[model samples]
Each structure stands twice: as structure tokens, then as C-alpha cells.
Target: MTTALTLTAAPGPDGVIVLTAAGEIDMSNAEAFAEALTSAVTGATGSRLIVDLTEVHYLDSAGLAALFAQADQIELRTGPLLAPLLEVSGLAELTTVHQA
Candidate 1:
């Protein structure tokens, strides 16, 4: 079954583009996540993109892959639950990860 996922992008106060994701991120909706992320990154232009995943309750490998693809152009903000996975997946090392 497909889970409900929401992605919204907007400019942050720091001048970075913020992509906020809510709900589960798995194979079912990974493509949508990737597409949204890509679009946010592209729109960032000279600034960086900050992917905020604090409201996300689940994220599978497919979601991680989408994140990896844009690692160079983005930073991440996640809750404690998903921070370890980011570290173990090596994504934390590639970019900044702020745990809240």
C-alpha cells in the first residue's frame, strides 16, 4: 500500500531553500520525494537546500537513495529517530545533519 507523503519547498530565513517532508518515505513514494527534492535543489540556484525530515515517521532505502543523489547540494534536519540511520548510511558524513 502507498503511504501519504507531503513535500513542500520554500525559502528559509537563512537564504537556503527548505524542503519539508512529512509522512512515510518508502519505495512507494520515493520517486515523488526525489522529484521534489530535485526541483527544490534546482530552484536553489546559488544557495543550498535544507531538507527537513523532522515529521517523517519512516524512511526506507529508496528514500535514502534520493537523499544521497542530492547530498552535495543539501543539508538535513531530522528528528532523533532517523538520525542514526543517516549516520549509518554515511549520508551524515557527506553533508550536514542537524538533529532536533
Candidate 2:
């Protein structure tokens, strides 16, 4: 079943693009997540895109794959609980990850 996911892309301070996501990110909604990331990345001007996953409770391989696809164009901000997943997946190595 598909879970509830909220994606909001907005401009942050210093002309940064911020995509704030909330809820579970699994196979069911990974495509939508990927599309949002793509849209945010493509629409980004000259600044970096920050993907905030602090409120995301769960993420699966599909979700990770989506993030990996845009690793070069986005940074990640997540809570302590999800930090290890990002690190273990090697996504942190490819892109910046901030634990909050």
C-alpha cells in the first residue's frame, strides 16, 4: 500500500533550493519521490539543493536509489535515526549529509 508522503520544494536562505519531505519512502512512493527530486534539481538555479528528511520515518532501497540518482546535485538533512542509513548506503560519501 502507498503511504502518506509530503514533498515541498521552496527557496531557502542564500538562494538555496530546499525540498522538505515527510512520511515513509518505500517502493510504493519512491517514484514520486524521485520525480520530486528531479524536478527540484532541474528547477534549481545556480545553488545547491537541500533535501530535508528529518520527518521521514522510513525509507527503503527504492528510496535510496532515487536519492543516489541525484546525489551530485543535492545535499541531505536528516534525523539521527536515518543518518546511519544514508551513511551505510554510501550516499553520505557521494553527497553531504547533515544529522539534526
Candidate 3:
């Protein structure tokens, strides 16, 4: 079983679902993380998602794939994925970059 991920939801000024997650994202917990993120973005009305990975210390292919997949869905909603780590250093250096 994957370790439980923490998700905090607070209403933004524009009523966007601001979910904060802090922990390692890998095969062990990617599914849960993906579910929470996907649901929050898809259900939110603003169609904006800001994933803060500043606290994530580790990530695996599964985690990367999950993020990539979520990014794909967000594109249709005109929502862009804002990732701090994925930006400073692209996920390509890591494994399963083809997913991106």
C-alpha cells in the first residue's frame, strides 16, 4: 500500500481549489496523488491549477507520468500546470520523461 498523501483544500478569493501537497511522489503514492489532483482540478470551476512541489523531496517515473497525464487533461480545460521543480529542472533528466 502507498503512504497516505495529505491534501488541504481552501477557497481562494476567486473560489479556486487550492490543494497543497507535501511529500515524496512515487509509484508507492502516485495513484493517490493523481486522484486527488485530478479531482480537484477537474471539479474546480476556475480551471486553474497550481501544483506546489517545493516540498517534494523525491519523485519516480510513476509520479512523473501522473503529473504529465494531469497536464494533458488540464490543457483541454485551458488550464496550465505550474510546477516549480519541473520548471527549474525539467523532468527529462529523470526517467519516463517520454510521458512529458
Candidate 4:
């Protein structure tokens, strides 16, 4: 069964576009995540995009790849649980990862 993922976009300080994501981001829902992220970036009126993953409980390789695909166009805000994974996976080098 496919897991459900929720994504929301809003404007942030300093002309940043923030895309907030919640729920599991596994293979089942990676495409949805990617689409949402793409839409957020493309629809953004700001120069920078910030993806907030504080509410995301899980993210698999597919989800990581989706994020990586857009790393150059976005920054990431993640909780402690996912911070190390992003760092170890070298995604941290492609984009800024803010730990909360």
C-alpha cells in the first residue's frame, strides 16, 4: 500500500520559499514528494527554497534521491533523527541542512 505524504508551501523570511513536508517518504510516496517539491520550487516567488522535514518520520533512499535531485535549488530543515543520515549520504554537501 502506498503511504500518504502531505506537503505545504509558504513564504519565509528573507524571500525564501518554504515547503513543509509531513509523513513517511518512502518508495511508495517518493514521486509525490518529488512532485510537491518541484511545484514548490517552480511556484516560488523567492530566490531560495527551504524544505522543512521536521514532521517527517521516515525517509528512504528514494526520498533521499528525490531531494538530491533538487538539492541545488533548495535548502533543507531536518530534525535530529534524519540529520545524520543526510550528512552520511553526502546530501549535506549539495545543500544546506539546518538541524532542529
The Cα local distance difference test for each model comes to 0.96, 0.95, 0.57, 0.91
**Candidate 4, residues 48-87: lDDT per residue as tens digits?**
8999999999999999999999999998999998998999
Better of 1 and 4 by TM-score: 1
* Candidate 2 lDDT by residue in tens digits, 1-100: 8999999999988789999999999999999999999999998967899999999999999999999999999999999989999989899999999888
For model 2, the run of ten residues with the poorest summed lDDT: 41-50
User: Residue 88 error for model 1, in Å?
Assistant: 0.7
Q: Write the per-residue lDDT of candidate 3 for residues 5-87, one digit (tens) a residue.
A: 66655555775555566667778888888897788777775556555554566766787677677664332111124244454
Of the two candidates 1 and 2, the one with more favorable lDDT, higher being better, is 1
Angstrom error at residue 74, model 1: 0.5
Q: For candidate 4, what is the TM-score?
A: 0.92
The ten-residue window of minimal lDDT in model 1 covers 10-19
The clash numbers for all candidates, in the given order, read 0, 0, 0, 0
Q: Look at candidate 1 and give me any clashing residue pairs.
A: none
The candidate that wins on lDDT is 1
TM-score of each: 0.97, 0.96, 0.62, 0.92
Residue 66 deviation, candidate 3, in Å? 1.1
What stretches of model 2 exceed 4 Å from their correct place?
none
Q: Estimate, for each residue in 4-98, the C-alpha lDDT of model 1 and write its tens digit.
A: 99999998887788999999999999999999999999999999889999999999999999999999999999999999999999999999999
Q: Which has the better TM-score: candidate 1, or candidate 3?
A: 1
Query: Relative to the unseen true structure, what is the C-alpha lDDT of residue 43 in candidate 4, on a scale of 0 to 100?
Result: 83
**Residue ranges of candidate 3 with Cα displaced over 4 Å:** 72-100
